[model samples]
Target: MARIKDVAAQAGVSVATVSRVLNDNPSVTEETRNRVHDAMAALNYRPNAVARSLRTEATRTLGLIIGDILNPFFSELARAVEDEAREAGYTVIMGNADERPDQQDHYVRTLMEQRVDGLLICPTAEVTPLVEEVSLGERPLVFLDRTLSGVEVPSVRADGSTAIAELVAHLRGLGHRRIAFVSGPSTLSTGRERTEAFLRAAAEHGLEVPEEYVRVGDFRAGSGRRITAELLDLAEPPQAIFLGDNLMTLGALDEVRERGLDIPGDVALASFDDVPWFNHINPRITAISQPTAELGRRAVRLILDALHGRPTDSVVLPATLVVRESCGETGPGKEDGS
Candidate 1:
């Protein structure tokens, strides 16, 4: 097999310059890059990835830990991250934590062992000791969607406060006074933030939310279905229901269908993390539309920036309300620009 020395000799350049070309380092002039490429092609030389990674102390790989793989939002976000990472010349290793803190820790340890260049995590409710340790370490870390307070890591997530408020106002305009929210685990930042936003929005409109009206779920479809069933069973059921995420929205829809209740008739429905399928489904769901793909792109950029010794800052994208028939889009709430 042709070696680096042979390519270097053939290209009439030093081995170090050949190595720079192999690494695609821009410092190598265009003429030198072309010469190195031609030499490699003529000699049929293929650089050793393992040796390069060992020498450089960089794997050109990123670890991504998502909350749940089954959730459409997470799945889509993973796809976007992968696409952007590939374009940036890095491979991505994804871990499905399934919203379990223990599982998340397992991936963290495993990825660190693999020596990934950086990590992008959508954290669970509880931060494990391992997680805390890694955050304090020198590795570049970026939070995806969910964040932990005082962690000091940069994050890429959406601000849904305005969208949640608009949703509540839309419900109120449709005459939905007794509304309910099916939320995710309280341990995660998203669950807590969404709940707080909902409460604040409700209070602003003089709507009283009983303690029972707030139900916490596992951010999965099953939890959504279970919570929806329970909510519908109340003696005085909520006139409208707002689910925290798309997977929960699916479960809520399943429960609604099983009970033969019509959306916007028996119980109006709205959800956060609008997925593509939401628009295709019958009656169409009302949702808080986030820049899901952009969130993924930004997460990769932030982590890469950190890896490159560049300054990094947290990015918060905006979430907007998309009015649809599921929430009975009455004209009163239209003024909020939903």
Candidate 2:
């Protein structure tokens, strides 16, 4: 392999100049940059990431810990983060925590051991302390999706309450007095926030949100299907169900199909995070679309900013309600902008 010294000799420049050119340092003249590029092309030279990391004390790599890689929301977010990181000349290492504390802890430790330059984490409640310690360390850390309470790490998230409020209001507008809230495990921040928001919004709108009408699942499609089945078997079945996340939404759809229940006709549906298949499905799903791309891009920017010695802070991106056939045209809530 062509080494830096070889490139330097080929380009008739010092090793320092080669380094500057490779790093795209603004101080280097365009003519010098061209010469270095020409030499690199001629020699087929490739920078050694391991060597560069040793010299700079930075791996130029980021660790991404997601709640569930199977979920389209997380998958899309991961893709976005990876794309943005690549554009910024950084590599990404991903881990799926599956929303389990012990698993999450394991991944965090494993990533740290890899000596990643920074982290973009969607923390499980069990790994709160793990995140805190990492944030206090030298590594730049940014929280994505769910964040720990009282721990002031820079984060990017969707406004859960506002999205829930909109979902509830939309249902109410559709003449749904008894709306059920199907949620995931309550231990995570996202689940808790959505549950709290659902209850609060229903109460504010003079709707009775009975405990029996609320069901907590594992945020999986199967969980959604099982919980929806249980809800349907209840003494008082809900007219509509507001799902907390996309995976659960899929489960609910399967349940409806399996049980021969018609969406919007038998039970109206609205969910958070518009997954890619929403539009293509038989009965298109109505959803609060979190800015998935923006979330990933912002997380990358925040991590890079912190690495560059810039101040890091939390950022909550807005959500939008996408009207579709599942909720019908006159769906319950009035979207904030709509």
Candidate 3:
């Protein structure tokens, strides 16, 4: 109900003086600033953020578009991003794509229309032309967790090669030769890289993975369940199964339970992303844990650097393997050893 004019009239100062005080301009005397503050408090006046942003041409807000909010990995990443942004005096708007390219594009366009100072995205499998358009435009953009090929945007992602190799080696030590892989869709970089890494590692251990052993899923629980079922139906089923992500791992676990299969006894299990629930689950899951919070912090820093016209570079953090009961490692062993 109160406006700047009301504050100015109450403070007995010019509207320009009120504006300078609100903007924290040092030219205004302390006495005048206190008067303006008192008037504002008395009238319960709130400044219009839209008007301020329009004048400065900076919204002081960032947009984040995640592939799937349902995935615990993305949800944790979002929380970290929000925390880092808030600490840096910026606000964040998040969009959940639910692993759909169309929905991802819609959020991107919507955030752009809202004049977000920068954007961070964990892109979906299908690449939308709008992503390229945004990257080429004036707005600073960064990719998180996942990225698109041929796009030059700066990004922060985990390098899972070493961890995947470690996992395969661990399985080999456990005497699992016929390893099956439930891979995510190959449309995104993480999917392709992870699958490629797993196969390469399996070969290094002198193990052969049949083409039938590799099942591709859409990074959802349903796909995980279906793929696991298919793998179980094979005449010569795999001795162990590696899931691409946490959501799919849940599905695989469900199918294994439905068939009354005992983990590490009937079929060994492992997953890529390590979430909080992984530890409390019946068979503590073995996982390659990415530096998720660090990734979020680094992503914000990259976008802020670009926003301030500073040099920026892409970052690739390494993942570490956490051995647990699910991978048949229950004894006292080194956390980082195979």
Clashing pairs in 2: 169-333, 170-332, 170-333, 171-332, 174-332
Q: How well is each residue in 1-338 modelled by candidate 3, as lDDT tens digits?
A: 78777889999997667766766778999999999999999999886443233223689899999988888888889999999999999999999998888998888878877878988999887655567546655567899998888778899999999999999998998888999999998888999999999999998999999999998998899999999999999999999999999999999999999999999899999999998888887788898899999999999999999989999999999999898988776545644333
Better of 1 and 2 by lDDT: 1
TM-score for all predictions? 0.80, 0.79, 0.82
Give the winner by lDDT: 1 or 3: 3
Q: Write the per-residue lDDT of candidate 1 for residues 1-338, one digit (tens) a residue.
A: 78777888999998768867766677999999999999999999886543233223789999999988978888889999999999999999999997788999888878877889888999987866556546645567899998987566888999999999988888887789999999887887999999999999999999999998999997888999999999999999999999999989999999999999998899999999888888888788888988999999999999999989999989999999888789775464442232
Worst 10 residues of 1 by lDDT: 47-56
In angstroms, the error of model 2 at 198 is 1.1
Which regions of candidate 2 are displaced past 4 Å? 1-56, 330-338
What C-alpha lDDT values do all the predictions have?
0.86, 0.81, 0.87
Candidate 3's TM-score: 0.82
Candidate maximizing TM-score: 3
- Root-mean-square deviation of candidate 2: 13.4
| Candidates 2 and 3 compared by TM-score, better number | 3
Give the C-alpha miss distance for residue 49 in model 2, angstroms.
Answer: 22
Clash counts per candidate, in order, are: 0, 5, 0
Off by over 4 Å in 3: 1-56, 335-338
**Tens-place lDDT digits, model 2, residues 1-338:** 77676888999998768877765678899999999999999999876433233223688899999988888889999999999999999999999988787887777777777778888889887644445445555567788988787666789988867867877787787788989988767877888888888899999999997888988977788888888898888888999888888889988998988989899888888887787688787678888899999999999999999899988888898888777768756443532222
List runs of model 1 lying over 4 Å from the truth.
Answer: 1-56, 330-338
